[model samples]
Target: MNLLSKIDIRQLQVLKALLEKRNLSKVADQLGISQQAVSEQLKKLRHNFDDRLFIRTSNGVVPTPFAQSLQTKVTRALASIEDLLIAEEFDPKTISTTFTICSTDLEQTVILPKFLTLLRKHAPKVKLAVKTLSLDDIDSSLLTGKVDLVITNPMFAPNNYPSTTLYQEQYLCVASKDNQDIAVQSSISDVAKIPQLVVSPSRGEFSGAANKWFADQGHPRNVVLSVPTFTAAKACIAHSDLCGFIPARLLPDPTLKIISLDKQVPGFDVIAVWHQRSSQDKLHTYIRELLMQAASE
Candidate 1:
């Protein structure tokens, strides 16, 4: 008889329980089976593997090197099976999980407020964890299950991963309402000459997305300051003589005013990206939909 023919899913379950509990009685209780049944399953498992998978001890049992090596593989297999079953019977209201999102200050300010409101209404029990976006760590973090979603410009998102464009965001040339030099309807050349504050979150350099636009108009931005976040840039621009481009959604501020340009500045698409492992996950799909809705609003 082939060894594969003798093995079954129940045997694998028994092996997993035993590996975790280490005691036959505990494994049996957890699985709602008798100790004799567990031992019988173990006996078959040992015979199939042709190894003494565990050794009897005063404490109950100890896994051999061979059995120890199987722990990760077995755990992963069981989790995958569980995910498969959950996908078929998923309900958003019943889910009680914490999802982590990686985002910049811009998304946190504009997207998260709406997304959180919808999330709370739809899945009250679901929690959220927000991590500041780190360009250097995004690839490894997504691959290692550190972040569930990334909300940012499509250009910054990981290449070839699953992503959906949430919305398009336009930039507004904003300056202090009190600034006498830069006024509304300021030309691009005029705005570029003023001491400009650039939001360069990922890098410390003074360059920004609007650099190419400025260069095309025969004017290079005189970036006098480089802040790491939009919040900081906004504060600095409001108090100082500095001006910079900010997302349009973050407007209506009492402290700053929008500087109408001679020509409209280009906008970029905001996108949500996730790991391929979550492509079939119901929760991820629903969350992506919520993001789109939130962006639209």
Candidate 2:
């Protein structure tokens, strides 16, 4: 197979639009190019792919099998490239744009509130579009331009995607006011043996690195019930005899104990990851940088 050159990206995009829109005039209108130009691009694309790419039908142009197979990947690759170009030319003050991001509920609940408030005060014109996606979905989404950023704690994709560490993923052992001695636990085993409350994202993603730590430490632990947020987890521990972890930044509650795991279990670092391709877009670049700054401080 021959390598796809940069010039081919535009041709593939035309094929993509043709495959989707079916009508030459409609495709041209959507692309803001003349119908003749669309036809010329399509002609070039058909020659390059050597596949009909699209076939005329009563309804409109229909993608051939080969074109159908190649459409998504080609579109995503082109989109990734587009993101890189746009990000390279970004200007935060003058340009107004929206960015889509995928993150854990914990990050959404805690960090996003702060980030939104900050952006509102400083960058009112900027907009954010947040969605929930499992860790498993991030890379494919990035490939397809589904989400601009993926935020995680203690780790990133195994693919070695570019990432910026925001802060330490903190964990503090906590108990109810009646059982404040939770912090005095000496070992992971000791902490584990304590009645524990579990908090997991909608995708079963744990808020932090505790699950991984448990697996690595060669320990099997017990979990009572899984809740949604740190606040909820805190509520469970406060009302019951259970103990669990919270972010270190959240100070100990008077009714609920908080103990930093600085000694027993290491804090996981926060990370914001994006495809290197994301750096090409002015919007992606500005938002990624702004989020990076938000994550760092």
Candidate 3:
């Protein structure tokens, strides 16, 4: 006999319902079938599994050890099949899963606070873990489930992952409050002459638009420091004469000054990305929408 052609999915579902409900009538009610229909399914299941499966008792029925052993596997298989056919609806207030995010300091500072506040109001039980976006293998991490989401510059996002751009942001030149050169609004050339701080999150020795801007105009910046994070660059600018360009949305300290560049420095799009596998996940899509809303605000 061909085992594949002999067993039926409906029979497996009936077995799962029997294990949970433990009575013919209750299983029929739960499955929207009649008690007679349920018995017919159980009869087929008995022939397929070659066991008594369930025994009649005064309390209704009891599972045989064979049936009991198959209960967990049968329930899991049905649940997996159901999930493939229908997306489980998400109610944020009741969800208790933790979501891991890969991001940069700028996004963590600017985006996470608002997202957390929203989550507290709605999804109080949901948790979040924010880690640095791996420069080497973020795509693999996302695809393999090491990370659930990524929030960063769209330019840096992996092409294979599905992404939504939240907002477009430009960089603003920031100088310490007491830094006289850029404090009073100097030319971009003069600003370049001052010690500059470069943000290179990937730790690559490459030039950004500002550097290229200076080079095209026949002068390159005197880059005094290169850091792997925006927070480090912020602290460096706040304490020393070094000046750096940071995302404009992250309003700088009231004491610090922002200077306009002579030539527009190209800006980047901020985006939220996730693996294609999670595209249909209700919670993932909900959080992605929340991020877009917060970024807009």
Candidate 4:
């Protein structure tokens, strides 16, 4: 039989405690075990090592050369075990992780700049990668680690992912500063007479809810231009006679005039969505909070 095999980790721990305190009672107190228990562990340790590990002296006890030599290795091993058991608390400033977020052009222009600035002020080492979302590819993108989070309408979000609505986005009409039709007309029929710019992010199909709304009311829109993003729509509207709908949250430029449409275009719920794997992530949670704060502001 191997003597080392007979010795358990508890015996090693007791030996370490005994060496440090140089007293049996102190070792028991430190380990929260009975004095007899400590003595029994020490006896097993002594028998295994074939040494009088400690000897009583006038002060308390003196360690043998064997005990002194074993102390360093034992302390290091126990420290490592402790490290394995305790989880380190997260600190954002020291985090060097890169988060990839999926977003649309409107969100990139209106939301991300503020979010990035706030993130850098606290977690300077953390990095961000912004990618355009392909609604059809969301499942693979999230599962394969291509994107960490998505900022978009919850209606278009993947069902399996977790999401929180950051804010409600309402639509408002925008026209060029000199567009006479929009400036002079307050009725939906008169507004419909002017050419309209439409945002068709998926296929630039020149058709959506606005057209349907007009059609439902017996007057269809004459969509003269179709663009893929809000930025493009804004640029086209500012430079031409076309009028278009945009999110109310985005700040308008002086070259464009914002019009409150008489007809109601259903607003969307902008949500922050993430994969199931990141549901409990501390950093991801913090970033989500920051986004919510930015949206509220």
Badly placed stretches (over 4 Å) of model 2 are: 1-90, 154-160, 180-187, 205-208, 211-219, 259-263
**What TM-scores do the predictions have?**
0.73, 0.60, 0.72, 0.70
For model 4, residues 105-208, the per-residue Cα lDDT tens digits are: 87888788888888998889999999876767777888898898999877568887899988888888789888776763356776778889887666667885
lDDT per residue for candidate 1 within 1-297, as digits (tens), equals 887699887888999998999999999999999999999999999999998999999999999999999999888988887888773677788899999999999999998999999999999889999999887777888899999998878777789899998888899999999998887887888888899988876777687888888899799989989988889989999999999989888887899998998988788998888899999888989999899899899
- Say which candidate scores most in TM-score: 1
lDDT of 2 by residue, 1-297 (tens): 564663466576677787677888898888888989988888877777677888877887888898889878878888888888873533455557777888866677657877787677666777889987476677788878787888875344545678777777657778787875565535776777776777665544433357667767876556767875666877888899887877766655787765544346667776787888876665666566667666656
Q: Taking the candidates one at a time, how many backbone clashes does each contain?
A: 0, 12, 0, 0
TM-score of model number 1: 0.73
TM-score, model 4 to reference:
0.70
RMSD of each: 10.7, 14.0, 6.9, 5.4
**Pairs that collide, model 1:** none
Ranking by lDDT: 1, 4, 3, 2
In model 3, where is the ten-residue run with the lowest total lDDT? 201-210
lDDT of each candidate versus the true structure: 0.89, 0.72, 0.83, 0.83
Of the two candidates 1 and 2, the one with more favorable TM-score, higher being better, is: 1
- Ordering by TM-score: 1, 3, 4, 2
Model 3 spans with C-alpha error above 4 angstroms: 5-87, 202-206
Positional deviation of 89 in candidate 1, in angstroms? 1.6
For candidate 3, lDDT tens digit of each residue in 1-297? 986698888888889888988989999999898899999998988898889999999877899999999988988888888889996667889999999998888888888898888878888998998898666667888979999998877657788789898878888888888777565556777877888888777755446546876788877889878888878878788889888888887765775688766666678888888899999888898888788877877
